[model samples]
Every structure is written in structure tokens, then in C-alpha cells.
Target: MINISRRIQVNAQSEANGVSLNRSQVWEGLVSKARNAVPYVSAITECNIVEDQGDRFIREVVLHGERLQELVILSTEQQVEFVRLSGNARGIIKNVIEEENGELYLRFSFDFSLPGVPAGSEKELEFATGMQNSYLDAVRSTLQTIRNKVSQ
Candidate 1:
């Protein structure tokens, strides 16, 4: 089992340009990404909301040429959690909106494992590192996408 986690401050760059996202706007963007991640995640080539139940839904996405199903739970403007139901990756990924000193921040975290990979082995470490980098880019892209939408 391998575990990777990280968080990036969403408004860090926006603060310099005088363009910032509030909690609600960020939350809306999160939900939109959850419904159809192809726009936010570069690796996700296809996305479809298979099931919808208000704040909770099931989505199917093709990520890196692999098909995956995820149960998405939305906690209003606070957080969005994606639990992988089927795929090589098995775990929970969360997009959370937080506030510190009245400044908004977005946090992305994930816990997952490859079925046959030995924990703590070099292979696992290498994979984790790549995944971490990919996820960091995804976070930055998500924020940028939201910023673009807000500006439009």
C-alpha cells in the first residue's frame, strides 16, 4: 500500500493579481469538475455522471486510458469527496475549501494503493512521487480553470 497527500493554497497567485475566489465560487467549480473532470484534469479524457442524487452522485471517468467509477459526495461549499469504486487506484480523494485569516484556500488530498505493489519499495515510492506531481498540477489547473470561468 502506498499513501500520497498534498495541499496547495488556491488564492496564493490570485492575491497578487487582485483576482480571488470566494468559498462559493470555488465550491461550484469543484462540483463542476466532479461532474465532468475532463476540463480540469488533463489525464481524464472522458467523464460522465452516471448517477445523480442531489449532493451525491456516481461518475465514470477514463483516466490515463483506464476506466474508473467514483462516488462523489458534495458537502455544500465545504468539500467534495471522491471515493474510487473501481479502478487500479482504490481510495478517497477530497477537494476541500478552507479559510485562514479570511483568505480562501483549496486543499486536495488522496489516499490510494496499487494492488500488487510492495509498500515502501522503490517502485512504490517512484509511483507515489509521480502521482503527487500529477496531482499538484491538477490542483493548479483546477484553480486556473475556475479563475478563467470567473473572469469570463
Candidate 2:
């Protein structure tokens, strides 16, 4: 298995429009219309919210294409400050804010594991990397859109 962990930070130092949105607003926008908001996640043909309450949810997403994987995602919000999420496909993606010295910061960490193929397997690695990179890019793009929306 190949494990990939990536961290993306969205803080005052991050390039964003002059808009500040709490973690709740960001989480809402992310889940409300996931397919429309995130591009690469378009692979998710179906999403069933099995359990939905105030600050917690268990959602199953059916992914399509060359492979079919049902990702069961568990998500929880910590008040309005942060959100924690996990899925069968990945370890967890945590979106949290850090308040240090009167400065607010937003951060996202993605940790996941992928099936590994034999070394020097061009096709397999290519496909694996492509899918992983697409997911990562989608999140980054979504965050940019969120910032734009809040600015407007």
C-alpha cells in the first residue's frame, strides 16, 4: 500500500479574497452540493446520507469510473471552529482554525492510502497518482471557491 499525506493551510498568509468565513459556513457549502462545488468529486454518482443530525453525519458515496468504491464518510463539526472528517478511502481530512497571537488560520490535512502495484508499473502508478492528485486538486479548488463566495 502507498500512503500519501498532504497538508493545505488557509490562513491570513494564504492568498484569499478579503472575506472571512467561519468553519461552519465552509462545511455547509462543502456538503450542500458536493458534486457541483467540487469538480473531481464528480466521480461520486450517488450520495446517501444515512445519518444526519446537528453536527454529525454518516454518508455513503458511490464512486464510478474504472473502479467502483463505496466510501462511507463520517463527519463532525466542533462548534463553529473546526470540522473533522474521515472516509473509507482515506484516513481523515481535518479542517481546523488556529488562533495564535490574535491571528486566525484555516488548515486542511488529507491522509490516505492507495493500493500499491509492482515497482516500475507505469500504468498502475499513473492511474493511482492521477486519481489521488485529482482529489487533492478538487479540495484546493473548492476552498478557493469558498473564499470567493464569502468575499462576494
Candidate 3:
């Protein structure tokens, strides 16, 4: 199996007034429409929640470039201010609204793995890492877009 991970911290403050932002509002806005997140997520060009049950749902997203489809189970926890999504054979993504040093921020972590690849195979690991690394720029751009779009 190949594993990939990244942590992105987004500043959540009003640029004009320097006021603290609302976590719930940001979360609601992000999940309200899957397309709203497309700009912030480089790999996913399309998002559709196929199933919904209040705090839990099934989302179908189309990956960019390759045009692959991935299905994920998503859950929200308002108390902890976090949203978690896991995909079969793909990986897991976690987004958390956090306050550090009295400043609000959004922390995003994504872990990816290929199910069938042998974990000990160096060649496979290298190939997988190279494949995922190609999308790094898109990912960074997506995060920047999210931070800019929301922090305004």
C-alpha cells in the first residue's frame, strides 16, 4: 500500500476588521454545496452528495486530470468542530476548525493509500509517491483559494 499525507492550516480571520471568524458558518458554507469546495480541492473537480442523513452523507467526487470517480462517507461533528470523510480503497480526509494562539484556523489532513500495492515494495512506493506528488501544486493552489475565498 502507498501512503500520502498533508497538513494545511488556513487562517480564519476577517482581513478588514481582524475579527474572529465563525467555525460553524465556515463549515456550513463548505459543505452546503460540494462545488463550493472544488476550487479549494485541487484533485476534485466535481462533488455530489449522493446520500444524506443530517450529520452523515455519501459524497461522489470526480478527480481532476484523470477523471476518476471516488465515493466517500462523510460525517460531521459540531461539538468537536471537525468533519471526517473516508473512502473505500482510497483514503481519509479530516478537516478541523481550531484556535491556536487565540487565532482561528482550519486544519486539513489527507491520507491516501492504494489497497493492493505491497507496502514493503520500494518501487511501488516510489511510483505511487511520484504520481501523488504531481498534484501537489494543484493542492496548494486549492488551499490558497479556500483561504482567500473564506477569509474575506
Which number leads on TM-score? 1
Clashing pairs in 1: none
- Model 1 TM-score, all chains together: 0.93
Model 2 spans with C-alpha error above 4 angstroms: 12-14, 30-46, 50-75, 78-120, 148-152
The full ranking of all candidates by TM-score, starting with the best, is 1, 3, 2
* Candidate 1 displacement at residue 97 in angstroms: 0.7
Whichever of 2 and 3 has more TM-score, that candidate is 3
* Per-structure clash totals for the candidates: 0, 0, 2
Q: Compute each candidate's TM-score over C-alphas.
A: 0.93, 0.53, 0.57
Candidate 1's residue-wise lDDT over 1-152, tens digit each?
A: 65666666778864325568888888889999998899999999999999999899999999999999999999999999999999986888888888888777788888888778877889878878888888888988888898889988
Task: Write the residue-wise lDDT of candidate 3 on 1-152 in tens digits.
Answer: 54454443444232323433356555554455333347666566777766666555565576544433333333452321122243333655555556667655554445556566666678666756664564455434544554455577
**Candidate number with greatest lDDT:** 1
Residue pairs whose backbone atoms clash in candidate 3 = 1-117, 1-119
lDDT of 2 at 70: 28
lDDT per residue, candidate 2, 5-78, as tens digits?
Answer: 44455444455555666666666556553323224255655655655554455555555533222232325332
* Error at 104, model 2, angstroms: 6.7
Q: Judged by TM-score relative to the true structure, which candidate is superior, 1 or 2?
A: 1
